[model samples]
Each structure stands twice: as structure tokens, then as C-alpha cells.
Target: MLATPIYIICSPCPQVGKTLIARLVCEFLLLKNGTAASFDVSLKEPSLLDYLPHITETADVIDTYGKMQLMDPLIFHDRVAKVIDLGFHAFDEFFKMCEEIGFMKETVRRYVTPIILFVAGSDRSSWRSYEMLQRQIPPGALVIIHNEFALRGGLPEAMVGEHVIRIPALPAFLKFYVDRLSFSFTGYLRDEKDWSTELHQWIRRNYTMIRDLELRVMGRQSYKPTAPCGRPRWHER
Candidate 1:
């Protein structure tokens, strides 16, 4: 029995708060489950390392030479919960690497436990990128988190497709804190306050939706079917 790994893939559109949302979600899950871990595949930036030290210790850096390697699947089985941060600028290269290594589909299916959190925003470009990603990702394997201004109209159900989960705009105060911290630490300004109290309230209101999305992606079983007569069925028939 092993716990599934959660993959947070930040879509193209810049400044969409993908990394921040990923960090907050990881923090929330860690606090709730007490056994979760977070990882960052951005070797160049290593943004999540400062926040979550435990998972960083085991992270594998992907550099320009195109070297991408992941930890053994068995190691992550049931021992830990993982949140992966995919950098915006590195999306194409990272995806190419995943394809080259055959890790995208193979690893996902082998682990039998994985989630793809695609973060998006309200702007036209961001929403467009979301639409594109939705089509590219595997069915029942995508979770959409919409990040918008607190007073904005929020997300539309039709835009993100059926399996989407909208995380409303972040509170003003939390957004300020995140912006300041991101600037001070990484020289990168990322505003992701939608994970604040106000946003959490929204998430709570829609908790069932989130749970259902998780179930669809990570709740898959590794068991195989046997003969109809209740007898052992061999693959080599």
C-alpha cells in the first residue's frame, strides 16, 4: 500500500502564481496529513527549497544539459505525499524531458497515484493557456485552480471544463505578504493570496469538488482483474 504522488504543473502564462499556489497547497496538505512532502523540479531556481527543506534534500535538479531524473517510485510509494512545482519558463523543456525519460505516462501509471494541478488566472492569456493545457492533459488527471482578484467575477465553470476546481481570489493581506516575501527572497514578484483565509473559505465551500477531483486522479487502484469463476487467472493463459 503506497501513497500517490501529486504533480503541480504550472502552465505557460507568466505571473499566474503557480509556484505560490503549489507551496500553499503543499503547506496545507502537510499540516492536515502530517506526512506529506513537497518537491521542486526547477533546478535553476529551486524556489521551494527554502520553504520545504525536507523534500528538497531528495530533489533532483534539471539543468540546461537536459538531465532530469526522479526518485525511485517504490521509495515514494506509501511513505510520503509529494507536491511538485513546475516552473513557468521551463514547461516545454521539462515536458520534453519527461517524454524522453518515458516518465510522464509510465511513472504515473506505475505509481497508480498522481495528480496534475494546473494553476490558471482570469486574464485572457492565462485562461487561454488553461484551455490549451486542459486539452493536453490526460482525462480525469487534471485539477484547475483559478487565481483572480478578490473582487473579480471569479471563475466560470465552462472555461475550465468539467473536472475543474476554482480557488477564488486570495485575500488582500495574504497577497501582500506573499508578494513581499517573493520579492525579498527570489527577486521574483509572485502574487498568490488565493490560498488565504478568504480563499480557504471558498475552498471549504467547495471541498467536495476538490475531494472528488482528487479521487478521480489519485484514487485509482493497482489491482488486476481475475477470472469470472472466482479462480486464479494467469496472464500467460
Candidate 2:
């Protein structure tokens, strides 16, 4: 059996498709394993819980009770895959609590890998936050996400060789349908007749990338090395 994964989809900047990626990961887990859960730590409207309320619970790290509620299940040895849609507002507090309590050490001991899918932004704050995460989390546990629509410019030279998962830009025609909370990626794959549509291809691309991420995390592949130059070395799914 694959090791249980706790995917924390986070970014210090809003509207960077962090929640969208979280939704995808949650749905992917549900379809792959038939059991999955998610935590919605966002203050934004149309968050992960909005899209997947049945499997998602609202979480907060601002106080002791809330922090325990959120972190306790994470250390469990159950095989259920967990996804956390962490928002910009809760980023600092959530990670601070993690560090304070030796969260990573506990998860490692439990055989539950905690992977941070950090959505990259062009701002300096985002860069600094990424750097801080590098220091706080193990290199293999930290994966950079590049949402094509969210990043206004290329990543800094410093981020060239990081383990990256890229979210492709959704075509204009498919965006309207996907924006609806009622739309489900797994449902579409099961029910859609034509598999050649842009939406189908887009969803498959993301699902493939996520599956590849899982395999790599399972130690089937080695972590990435520095790219030649200029080009960012993204993990090929």
C-alpha cells in the first residue's frame, strides 16, 4: 500500500489558485483511494470546503483547541489521504504552530508524509515565504507550484531546481464551467462522453501530475537536481 499522504496546499498570496489545487488533490485522492479528507483553513469565499464539503472540515490554528482539532488527526497512522487548503491569512500561524510542536517529526514517526505544495508568486513576500518553508520543512517535503495564470513573471533564478508541480492555464472556454462549486473533476471524468475536450485534457494533466507526485514521494524516484540554466526544472508528470 502507498504511504498515507498529508498534502498541505499553501501560499502567502491570495487568488493564486491555491484552493483550486487543493480541491484537485482532494478529489484525486478520493477517486484513487475511495477514502480522503480535507481541511479548509481559508478565510476566502468559495474555499475548498465550498467545493468539497462532504469530505472537508473547517480548520483553524489560531488557538489551542482549534490547533489540536486540526493537527491531531494528521499524526494518526490511518491510511486516509488528507489535504489541507491553507490560506494566506493562516499561513504564518499554521506553520508557526507546526514548528513549535515538532509537527514534521511526529508525522515522520507515524509514517505519514507531510508535503507542502506551495503556490509560487512573483512578489518578494512569496519568495521569502518559500525560503522560510525550505528552512522549516524537509526539502523533499516542499514542492513549489507554478500556476501559469497566477504568476505574472518568471520565477527567480534561485528557484530553478526545486521540485515543482505546474498547473497549466485553463482555456477560456472551460474556465466558466470549472469555476462552479458544483462541478466535480472526478464526476466529469466518469460521465463525460468525449475524452478529447480541452477540459478533459486539462483535468487529466493535473491528475497525472498529482499521481506522479505521489510516486516520487513514495521514493520510486529521486529528487530533482539543478537544471542546466535559465529553465526551471519541473517534475515531469
* Best by the lDDT measure: 2
Give TM-scores for every candidate, taking all chains together and pairing residue i with residue i. Answer: 0.65, 0.90
User: Could you give candidate 1's per-residue lDDT for residues 1-237 as a string of tens digits?
Assistant: 454666555765566667666666665565456666666655444377666666553344356332323434322346466677776666666555544554444444445455667666556655665666555566666676666652156564446345555555656775675554333211121233455545444544444454566556666645343233221111112
Clashes (backbone N, CA, C under 3 Å), per candidate, total 4, 0
Can you write out model 2's per-residue Cα lDDT over 8-59, one digit (the tens) per residue? 9999898899988998898899989998989999899988888998999999
Local error of candidate 2 at residue 58 (angstroms): 0.3
On a 0 to 1 TM-score scale, where does candidate 2 land against the true structure? 0.90
